[model samples]
Every structure is written in C-alpha cells, then in structure tokens.
Target: MGWSTKQIPSLRGRRALVTGANSGLGLQTALELARAGAHVTLACRDAGRADGAVATIRDQVPDADLEVRALDLASLASVRALAEALDGEGAPLDLLINNAGVMATPERRTADGFEQQLGTNHLGHFALTGLLLERLKAAPAPRVVTVSSGLHRIGRIDLDDLNWERRGYKRWGAYGQSKLANLLFARELQRRADAGDLALRSAAAHPGYSATHLQTAGPGQGGGVGDRLNALVGRVGNVLLATSDAYGAQPTLYAATHPEVSGGAYVGPTRLGQNRGPIGEVPSTRAGHDREVARRLWERSEQLTGVAFGLPAAEPVAG
Candidate 1:
C-alpha cells in the first residue's frame, strides 16, 4: 500500500546523472532510474568500480542504458571537467542527483584546501549543480535532488570558518555541518529558481540509516586498531539497525521523479526517528529554513567554489 518503486512513472527519454553511482544508495538510485527507462551516467571517482556497477545493473536490467564518467568531487578541476564534458554534449539533463558524499573522517583537506567533508559533501555538489544550470533549464521540467542526512539536525554553519581554519575539527560535527549545508543549498537553489522564474525544482532527501559503505569508509581511513574497531561497529550497525540501500534510495527516487514533490521539499522515511519506513515529506531543523543564513551560505559557496548559479537574488521582504 505504501509508495515504492512501483509508483515510479515511466522515465523514457529522460537523461539522468547520478554522482557516486558506483555502489550503495547511488547505485540503487541509478539502477531504478535506468530500469524506468532513463539513460543514466554513473559519475564516480573510480572508473573500474563504476564499470562493475554498470555490469551489475546490466545483469538485472539487460537493456539498461548507462555510462560511466570520472568525477572526483574533492577537486574543483575534476568537477569542472565533468560539467564541461556534459555541457559540450549539448544534451538536456532531466535529473541531477547529488548523492555522493563523505562522512565522519580523520581531519583531511580537499585539493581546494577545504575540509574534506564539507568540500566533497557540499561544495562539490554546489559547483556541479551551478555549472549544469543551463542543461537543466533546457529540460521540459528539470529536478535537482540532493541527498542530505538526519545528522544535519545537529549541524551549525560557521560562516567564519567553513573549512576548519579557525577552530579544532570534530569529524562528526564537520560531517553534520556539511549535510546541513546540503539542505540549505537545496532550499536556497529552489528559492533562487523561483525568484528567477525558472522551472527548476530543487529538493532534498535523507536515506535514513541505510546500510552502506559510507559509515565505514571514513573511519577505515585511519587504518589503526581503533579505526578497525569502529569500522566493525559500523558494519554491525548496518546489519542490525539500518535499512537496505534499496529501501534507502526511495526518498531520493521519490523526490527525483514524483510529480507531486515541489521545490524546497525535504523527503525521508516516516518512522523510527526517520531512520526507516515509508517515504514522505518531512520536517527540517529551524536553521534549515533560515532564509538569511541560506542566502549567506549561497553567497559564501559561490565565493569558495568560484562557481555562480547566475540566478536572481531573493527579493526584499515586504516589511
């Protein structure tokens, strides 16, 4: 009785690009979209793994239309490269799923000198979406679905030190900040689209504790006994407490293809602290809806990434 992949309408002729589509949630999202008749480009950091994912999806959907493209989100040059490649093709992009991200990890910085979590999870997607604005606008109805996390509830944006330059970094807090930035970015993007009278829909979704490598990838980086133990715990939690990645991808799929979903909508599971259950629109933190903060973050994102959305600014409030 609940909404599932069965509810996904035919996606024939639509062109989709899913970041981090080599495995887990992104892979599932790509597979389902391909099954629904979309031509999907699996944008990933590892070409081999992406090929493996493509083979796996082909095993299930023999006629699935898919391609692999290299994308390393931590580097702005890589982001620009992928965008430029797509732009040169002069094809309309119907769906852009900003699903690839990093979690809590030992302190690391991206090639752009940004903290790893924020850079990969937030800034990378920011630049990619902005760069792809024209292609998305070309579509009859373009949708941008960004994947955030429930952990975003605990996040606070430190506009003064987004890259961990001014203070000590707690990995989890840094991850939270990045995820919060995702929500704000999605909503702010929608606001700008509406202000500019563009037919672009920007929405955000959370997977709600999906069993994926995301949990272990960060901790495993340290390669120490404690890190190994943490990875083990993450695996254990995945088995015991998390939903399958297929189930987890529903919120994103819903946001991406569902006609009823609107700009600025946030989707997630509807039960158990939003960790697992049927998909539905969900509430976000009050900060998630703060217009001024979203505006400031938008401007800051442009400055940091050197990528601009080129949309009109939010209108002055009628006070």
Candidate 2:
C-alpha cells in the first residue's frame, strides 16, 4: 500500500534513457517508464538482446514508446558514442537511469584500463552524465537516478589506488567500491547543481535483493568448482529470497518519479535488511555522506574518465 508504480506521475512527452535496459531490473525500469508514457531509449551492450527486450515490452504494452541503442559501459568510447548520438538528435532528456552494471567479477580492466566494476558502474555513468549534461539541462526539470546496492555499506574508497593496482584484488570489495561511488557521485552532482544554481535533481536507489542475472553473471564466468558453487548459491538465493526484478525496481521508479523526492535522496526498500519491501528514503553509510571524500572522488572520476561535468565549483562555506 506504500508508494508503488501506481503513484508515478504521467510522463507524457518526457524522454527517458535507461542503461542496460535489455533485461532484468533495467528492462523492468524501462517498461514501467514506457507504460507511464515516456519515450524510452533502451541503451544496452548487446544489440540483438536489446531488440528482444524491446519486443518483450511491446508484447505487454503494444504501443510502448521504446528504442534500443548500443552501449558498452566497459568502454569509454562507447559511452561517449551514445551520448553524442543523443546530442545530435537535439532532444531534451528528462530522465536518465544509470542502471547498467556488473556485480562481483573476476579481475579485469575496462577499455580505459580501470577496474571493470568501478569503470562500468561509476566511471562510465560519470562520463555519460557529464557528456549529456547539456541535453538534460535543456529540459525544464531534469533528473538522474543512479542505482547502487546494499553491499555498498561495506565499501571503502581508496582514491590513491582506486583501480586496485597497488593492493590485492577482491571481487566483492571492488563491487562495493563501485556501488559506494554511485551514492557519492549522486550526492556530489546534486551539491554541484545547487552550488551552480542549476535546476537538476540527482538521486540514487538500490534494488533490494532483486532476482536478476547480475547475481549469477559474475560467478558464472569461472570454470572452477568454487565459481560453480557461487553461481548455484546465487540461483538459489534468487529463487528463495530475492524479490522479482519488477518489484525490486519500485525504489528506482519512486526515486525517479515521486514529486516529493528531493535531490541527494537515496531510495531503497524499507524492510528487513533493506532487501525487500515498500520503497522509502534510506540512509547510506557514513562514508557515503563524507562531503570531502565525495568531492575528491568526483575529481578523481573526472581525471580518470576525462569527462568534465562543466558545473561551477561549490563555494566554501564560512564557519
């Protein structure tokens, strides 16, 4: 009976772009937005699969407004390509769901040489958001929603060795860092917008234990017995505990559409361990609110991604 998709405001004439919209939570997010009358672009890594996703959506909402664009968050060039293409189209984008991501995965680097998790989950979205800032600003009211995770509670950001070059790599730790960065980046963006007097709303959300391919995608990559066990565990968890992808997506939907949702808000399930339930404002870790750390991470992200947000620097507050 809490805030569900039924409360979503009419999105007529609003244009939204959802990353990784080919399946799982991303697809669910895209579908609901389309149902609410938004012209949705499904930016995905695989073109064929994206087509299937579009078809699946159409099957449910026959007149759904949707398009598929190829996007590989593991590559900076690919992120820029999609942003530039949208720029060429010269249409304002009202909603941007930075939802595409990889969970715990084997040690690997993106095309830009950053750790794959941080690159895809944080840096890639960082670049895309910056590159498309103008497009967003063109709209009367613009919002960006970045998806994080409950695992972020344990994340520690190591600015000096963010790519994990100096220390030994831990897959879960890397994912935690990326998800934590999502929350940090979201707040920083809002701070910058307020400081610059820009009309932009930035928010973050986490799908509390959603049954998606993300749980198994990473573990399924290895051929070892441990990997197989991990994959089996993920599948079991999906069936036994996790909520449906559509249900998990409610937080993101609420964060994206709820009129009362303010800038810098972090939305998540409001139940046991924040894993599943009605959506509401949830507190992030203490680290997620460290202004100085968020500022530093923002600068580091720009340096690593080579994408400037082009917003004014926040003035120092007088004591």
Model 2 stretches with alpha carbons more than 4 Å out: 316-319
Per-residue lDDT of model 2, residues 197-264, tens digit only: 88999999999999999999997766888888889999999999999999988999999999999899
Q: Residue-wise lDDT of candidate 1 within 1-319, one digit each (tens)? A: 6789988999999999999999999999999999999999999999999999999999999999999999999999999999999999999999999999988898999999999999999999999999999999999999999999999998999999999988898888999999999999999999999999999999999999999999899867788898898888898999899999999999999999988997899999988999877898999899899888889999999999999989987885676
RMSD of 1: 1.0
Candidate achieving the largest lDDT: 1
lDDT values of the candidates?
0.95, 0.93
Candidate 1 residue pairs that clash = none
Model 1 spans > 4 angstroms off: 316-319
Candidate no. 1 TM-score: 0.98
